[model samples]
Target: MSFKALIVDKDDEGKTSAGVQTIDESRLPEGDVTVAVEYSTVNYKDGLCLGSGGGLVKTYPHVPGIDFAGTVEASDDPRYTPGDKVVLTGWRVGEIWWGGYAQKARVKADWLVPLPDGLTTRDAMAVGTAGFTAMLAVMALEDHGLKPGDGPVLVTGAAGGVGSVATAILAHLGHEVAAVTGRPETADYLTGLGASRIVAREEINETVKRPLEAETWAGCVDAVGGAMLARVLGQMKYGASVAAVGLAGGAGLPATVVPFLLRGVNLLGIDSVMRPHDDRLRAWGRIARDLPMDKLADMIQPATLADLPELGRAILKGGVRGRVVVDVNA
Candidate 1:
C-alpha cells in the first residue's frame, strides 16, 4: 500500500529539505510489526531531524518523528498482533529508520509497548517522547524519596513539551511547582498547567555566582542543562535530587561539586532512549494513572503532516508550546 509521509532528504551538497510525499510500503525498513500510525509528535529532536539532521539523522530521505502511537496492522512477533494499540518511542527509530511521520511504520516488536488502557492513540502522542521522558524524570525523583509536602519542585523550560507536562504532573501529585520560562506571555499558561509560581528564565539562566547558594528547590526536573542546571544544582535543598532530562540550553555542565559535597545533592541523568522494556511499561502505566487527562487535553495543539516543516523549526527555537499532536492520517 502507498501512504503519505513527511519525507526529509539531503542532496549531494548536503542541503536538506522536508515535504509531504507518497511512500510505498515496500520502501519501509525491516521489522516484524507494521503499524497503522494514528498520531505522532514534534520534539526538539524532530526539529533537528527535520532540518539539518542535528547529527541525529544519519540517512537521507528519512521520516523524522521520534515517537508514535498506532494499532498493529500486521505482525510476526507473538508479543503483538493485528488491531492491538501500541506506542513507540526512543531506540533512535526516527533518526536511523523511517519513522512515524508516515501513515504507517514497520518496526521491531521490541520497540513497541502496549498502549496503557486509559490512553488513546492520540493521547499517547500527546504524551509522546517528551512527556514520556518527563514521566521518567518524575519517577526517578519519587524513587529517590521526593514527596508532595517535601517542598517546591522546579521545572525549567516550563512552556516547552517536557517541562509543561512535568509541571502538570508535579502539581497534580500535590507538589508546589515552580516553573521557569523565558517567555513572560506563558506565565498564565504555566499556571493553568498547575505551576504555583513562574520563575523567569533570567532568574536562573545564568551561571552560578557561588557553588552553594540558597537551598531553594526540594527537587527539580531540569530540561535546560548547562549553566541553568549548574545553578539549580546549587539551589537544591539538602539531599534533594534533580533529574536532568535535556540540554536545551547547552550541553556543557559548568558546575561545581560543592552541592554534591556540602548539601548531598543528587544529579540524576535521565536517558529516555534505549530505556528497558519493563521500565517503559512502568512509566507508561504511571503516566496513564498520574497525568490528568483534562490537562493533557489542554496542552494539545493539533497539527498534520503538512504542518511539520514550520512546527519543526518552531520547536527548535522554543517557540512551540506544550505538546503538538500530529495526525499522520490527517
Candidate 2:
C-alpha cells in the first residue's frame, strides 16, 4: 500500500527541491482508476514543474512526469478493468494534478488510453507526449494534402524528441526528411533516423525581411517555433502545411502574413494535451503501424525515478537528445 515517487516541494522562501520519497496509498488523488506505473517520461513541462512550477504547477509536493504507461490495478470505470494496459498524457495531469512520477498513479479513466497492440509500456513511454504530438502534426499535414512525392518534409529541432520521431516517421512513410538542428554533432544521428538532409539551425532559425521566400518544403513538423517557425512559413511550398508543436526556441512569432496571404500556406497548431479520445487512439495506432520500432529504440536513453531531478533540468536546458524513458519502479 505504499509507492515511491519523485516529489517536488517548495520551501517557505520559495526555493524548490525534488527527491524520491515513499508515499502512502491513501495520499493518492481522487480518480476512477489506479495504475501500477511501468514507465514515465520527462518533458519540457516536467522540467518546469520539477523546478519553480513555471506557472504550470500551481501547488507544492507535485509529481512532474507528463506522460506514463502502465497496467490498471483497480478501476471503477467500465471501460477499464484491473490488468488492463493503459497510457496517460496531457490533460495537465502532472501540473494541475498528481501524475506518474511514481510506482503507482491514480487518474481519471477518461484521461487514459489503452496502449496500442504493438507497443510495450516502455515503448509507450519512449514515445511520450513529445512523440505523440509529433504524430498529431504528421497526421495534420497529411490531412492537409501533404504527400511523400511532393517534396521534402522539414522537421525542425530534429535531435529532440518530437523532431526525432517526426523525422523517423516521415522517412519511413517515404517522405524525404530534412532535419534541422543547432547541434552539428547530431547530424550523423539524424541521418541514422532516416533524415535525407541536415539543415543547420542557423540556416532557417532567423527572421527574414522577405516574408515569402522560394517555396521549398512540401510540409513541415516544426518544434522550434518562434522565429524558426516564422522563417519556415516563408519557405513552405504553396498551399503547404506546417504543424506547430512546440516553442523551444521561444513563444513569440515575429512573422508577417505574406506567407499565408500570398502563398495559401497553412499553419496548423498541434496540442497533444486535452486531445479527444478518438484522436488519441488514431495517433497511437498510426504510431504503432508507421513508426519504426528500431528507430524508437535508438532514440531512448533509459533512466530511473532517482534520475529525474537532474534529467528534468537537463531537458529544460535543451541538453537532452532523443527521448528519455524513466522506469518509475527502478
Candidate 3:
C-alpha cells in the first residue's frame, strides 16, 4: 500500500526542502506496529527539523513531527492489536526515525502508549508533546509541595503551547496564574485560558543587579529559559520550585544561585523525551483528568500536513500561538 507524507529532503547542494511525497509501506523502517496516523503536531523541535536539522535530525528524507496520535493498522506485538488507538512522543522517533507527518508510521511497540480513555486521536494530538511536557512540569511542582493557595504561579511564554497548557492546568487546579508574554495582544487570550494577571515580557525578561529579589511566585512553569529563567529564580517564594521546560529565550543562564542558597528555591529540569513508560502513562492519565477539553479547544488552531512548512517557519520565529493540531490525512 502507499500513502502521502510531508518529506524534508536535503540536496547535494546542501539546501533542504519540504513537500508532500507519495511513499510505499515497504519504505517504512523496522518496527513492531504500523499505525494509520490520524493527527500530528508542530513543535519548536519540529520547526528545527523541518528547516535545517537543528542538529536533531540525523538523516535526510525525514518526517519531522515529534508527536502523533493514531490507530494501529497492523501489529506483531501482543500489547497492541489492529484498531487500537495509540499516542507517541519522544524516544527520538521524529528526529532519527520516520515519524508521524504522514498517513502512516511504523514504530516500536514500546514507543507507543494506549490513548487514554477520555481522549480521541485528534484530542491526543491537540495535547501533543508540548502539553505533555507542561503536565510533567506541573506534576513536578506539585510533588515539591506547591498548592493553589500557597501563592500565585507564574507561567512564562504564556501564549505559547507549553505555557498555554500550563496556565490552564494550574488555574483548573485552583492556583492563581500570572502569565508573562511579550505580545501584549495576547493578554486577553491568556486570561481566557485562566490567567488571573498578565505580566509583560519586559517586566521580567532582564537580569537584575540584586541576586535575591522580593519573593513572589509560589511556583513557576518556565518555557523561556536564558535570562528570564534566571530572573524568575530570584522571585520564587521560599522553598518554591520552578520547572524548567524550554529554552525559547536562550540556553545560557547568566545569574547567581543566591535564591537556591539563601531561599531554598529549586529549579526542576523537565525532559519529555526519553521519559519512562510509567511516567508517560501517569502524565497522559492526569492530562485526561486535569486538562479540561473546553480549554484545550480554546488553545487549538487547526492545520493540515500541507500547512506544516509555513507553520514550521512561524514557530521558529515565535509567531505561532497555542497548539497547532495537524491532521495528517486532511
Candidate 3 TM-score over all chains jointly: 0.99
- Residue ranges of candidate 1 with Cα displaced over 4 Å: none
* Error in Å for residue 195 of model 2: 0.1
Tens-place lDDT digits, model 3, residues 98-182 = 8989999999999999999989999888899999999999999999999889999999999999999999999999999999999
Comparing 1 and 3 by TM-score, which wins? 3
Q: Candidate 2 lDDT, tens digit per residue, 211-243? A: 888999999999988999999999999999999
* Global fold similarity of model 1 (TM-score): 0.98
Instruction: Find the 10 residues in a row with the least total lDDT in model 1.
Output: 206-215
Cα lDDT for residue 121, candidate 1: 94
Runs of candidate 2 with Cα error greater than 4 angstroms are none
Looking at model 1, residue 269 earns an lDDT score of 92
RMSD of each: 0.8, 0.7, 0.7
Model 2: residue 248 alpha-carbon error in angstroms:
1.2
Q: Give the per-residue Cα lDDT of candidate 1 at 131.
A: 93
Task: Tell me which residue pairs clash in candidate 1.
Answer: none
